[model samples]
Target chain A: MSTTKYFAPSVEYAAKILIYLSRYKSKQSTLTEISKNLDINKSACLRVLKTLEANNFVYYNSETKKYSLGTYISVLGKRVGENLDYLRIINQFLEEVCELTGLTAALVQRVSFDRVMFISQYQTQIQPRLSISVGNRFPLTEVSYGKWILANVSEEERNYHLREGLKKVTSYTRTNLQKYIDELSEIKRSNILVSRQEYTNNVTAISSALYDWKGQILGMIALVGVSSLIDEAEEQRLCTVLKEVTNRCNEHLIQLKIEAYEFPYESKITQ
Target chain B: MSTTKYFAPSVEYAAKILIYLSRYKSKQSTLTEISKNLDINKSACLRVLKTLEANNFVYYNSETKKYSLGTYISVLGKRVGENLDYLRIINQFLEEVCELTGLTAALVQRVSFDRVMFISQYQTQIQPRLSISVGNRFPLTEVSYGKWILANVSEEERNYHLREGLKKVTSYTRTNLQKYIDELSEIKRSNILVSRQEYTNNVTAISSALYDWKGQILGMIALVGVSSLIDEAEEQRLCTVLKEVTNRCNEHLIQLKIEAYEFPYESKITQ
Candidate 1:
């Protein structure tokens, strides 16, 4: 077996470059400008820039030595827009959950290792909502959605992520690996994860996985609000609503021909 | 003078890889999969993927060997959402214009060389709204928004984009360079670009430029509807409404401290 693990190192670099570009897409940036701004080595940056230019990610004015994002960046922008339309189908359901629970509702997904991305959110009319951008990422190990995803991940993958030690994002975050793993197993069995300010203080969040037709986790739906508003009773009610709304969303996905899958692998150790 | 352009090569490569990744983001292809799909050498794909990976634009599962988008993909998603918020701010104005003219009202931005991204839209009650995604891009040299953007682009950039001939996307699209440039100049001075079935037969569109506080062309506001409903009188009314709405948006941008600039340079050649 060829033991070379496919490390997509360049993809990571390109993504970093794109994020850097997002901040200044409206303006032109020179090669040295990008290198200095990003702290990337000049020669490597030059090579990447050449590849990007050839591919249409940017256009370089040979005369002025200026570079701007190419038209294709907008193509990706368009895809993002199309993906957002998927959220509209669940908006009403999310709003109802928010109204019924008096909590801020959110949709989130585990986009990568140790990072959970917020997809959409609905705020209660009275309580102030968390300022979470749709595409913003937070530490996966320290969030309710993160735990939910961890609950579903394979043991090998879980160990890989956990080996780094859950970087403490907040004082309330779980620090013990065994405890965190146990909690994930429990949540996996029960299909819900609840935390009292795991990511922030004075906030309670209860989340359930949003599954496709075949039971694969597409994302998580959660209700978060002031800790005072979500006691055990409120948590139960929120869970009930979360389950119902998630099922409704799954049905919508089914209509769209998406299959939901259960966690694909069996847990190695019995809890 | 050091004539060697910096960031040009990297920008080019970035654009190419981004376009490639976009074609597969929805499909969830692996690096090997992308290599095959793009018909590029696997080693090159690996290099590109590594760069994208480091930047959080693409992610791969070492266990499953599956590749998907990373957290940074959401950065563009958030941009579209922010732009949607901008559209929301002007929705009332667009709705009023739609009602006044019995046409479909839209907010568009030049997203690429030949594409206009639709930000938001409202259709008159009687007319079925043209279904366009919030991030959808249309060619800039063909439709009303395209013509408007072409008219507003600096002479140099405009010539650069037009040198290879505008991509003919629709049957009524103009292929002649000089004629189109001439028409664009007329539209630029008049502050309006009108198209009759240029993008789609039976659809007539009239557009005006949206400017920032400093009066720079930010985007275009357009009205589209069936040709029968868009006579000379209707075109005049729609043009007036577009100008007024654009002015309101500009005032809003001014309040937000955005600078508007006109096309950087004027063409030397005259009709």
Candidate 2:
């Protein structure tokens, strides 16, 4: 997957149109509107939108001459939920964590080299609880999952990532280089990372890394709650439950030997 | 949304790539395999794929030199679920139907001019039950929802749609034009559609249309079970429950006046 100078500007604009529609999904947008807002030529926007509508990625309302996100989006989402075995399995564990701890539990997977995303979540029914939704993304150095990743990687690589230093997300965020590195060392030893109001103010999160059969980091199981509702004792108790669940999850992953599962679609790039 | 001869070939190919990845989501595919399978020019495919990867619509695994569906797919899916107000409300009603009748409940929405997709479903826990997933699409002339749709439309339009006749999905499928029209007329009077083994073998379904405050056809609420488990008496009972629920749902929609809800993002296309 070497970086290539060749690019498809039409495809890029098409993606932009889809994302713009996603933000205003409840409303319909006309081609001219999309073109002006996205700053693409009107003719080009129409072509892209028509191609998308032809594929059911966007729904065009003929009566009103407007477009919205289409049913294919739901279909793709369903595929993501069903085809990913690990996501399916982790969702059940997330539900259990939400029920047991009365806190929002989320499964965050590394989506790219520098981003981790919440792919699944079970919100607690408890009042004044923290809420997290699937698809929320954070930078690799900005969340508890990032802490786990940084702790587990080679020291050289970790240092390379840390060269920019951490941004202060909240008042409690650890931006000091020495202190943050010390915390990463502790995370490496304990396999658990806890932060209060570091990502979002008034929220405390307890996160632990999960591994697959190959001993590769798969994702992070994070439990979060309102800081006002969690005292020191409650945090400790919730942390224990979270650790136990992640440990069980990792053990189950090893027993399943999931990494060895066949991927029949490999087409080697000869280039 | 006038039909246009103009098309963006690159955008179309990009969509095809994403859909292909969706089918083989658990595995990664090499650029060559994607190009060969999709018959897209190798260079063109690489450019589109690189654009997709840059946008997080596809993830490139550097070590394996392969690509898979990316996190943006999940994000777009999340947008569909969260932004569609009716889908969210109907989901709760579907859950109730599942609990009340111990049958799989689903919400079907018209997607395109001639297609309807299963956008939401709640599978039954009962043994020997049917299972349905979101995104399963069918022609508007086939399923129970189609029955409601056909019945609701003008006679001339309905006759035109009926001219081709229905396909024989099973021995019980109604293929005779007149007989199908008669059944649709019955549905018109009762506002309910009952189908057994018409879409799939051994599956019995009862569906009714839901309406917004404007009385337009919103979608269908369907309850399905194994035909063997649903005798004539059981079917009648289930029909009654389905009708009652849909009526309640309609009343709720009217009260909410959901269509009156503001869509702040409407930018009209001034030709």
Q: Pick the candidate with the highest DockQ.
A: 2
Location of the lowest summed lDDT over 10 successive residues in candidate 2 chain B = B262-271
RMSD of each: 7.7, 7.3
- Separate DockQ for every predicted complex: 0.21, 0.30
Q: Please state the error at residue A243 of candidate 2 in Å.
A: 5.4
Candidate 2 lDDT score at position B124: 67
Instruction: Give the C-alpha interface root-mean-square deviation per candidate.
Output: 7.2, 5.8
lDDT of 2 at B59: 62
**Residues B160-184, candidate 2, lDDT per residue (tens digit)?**
6677788887888878888888888
Name the lDDT value of residue A266 in candidate 2. 19
- Per-candidate TM vs. native? 0.66, 0.72
**lDDT tens readout by residue for model 2, A164-234:** 88888888887888988889889867878888898788888899888877776778899988888899999
When just chain B is superposed on the true chain B, each candidate scores a TM-score of: 0.68, 0.77
lDDT of 2 at B73: 78
Clash pairs (backbone) in predicted model 2 = none
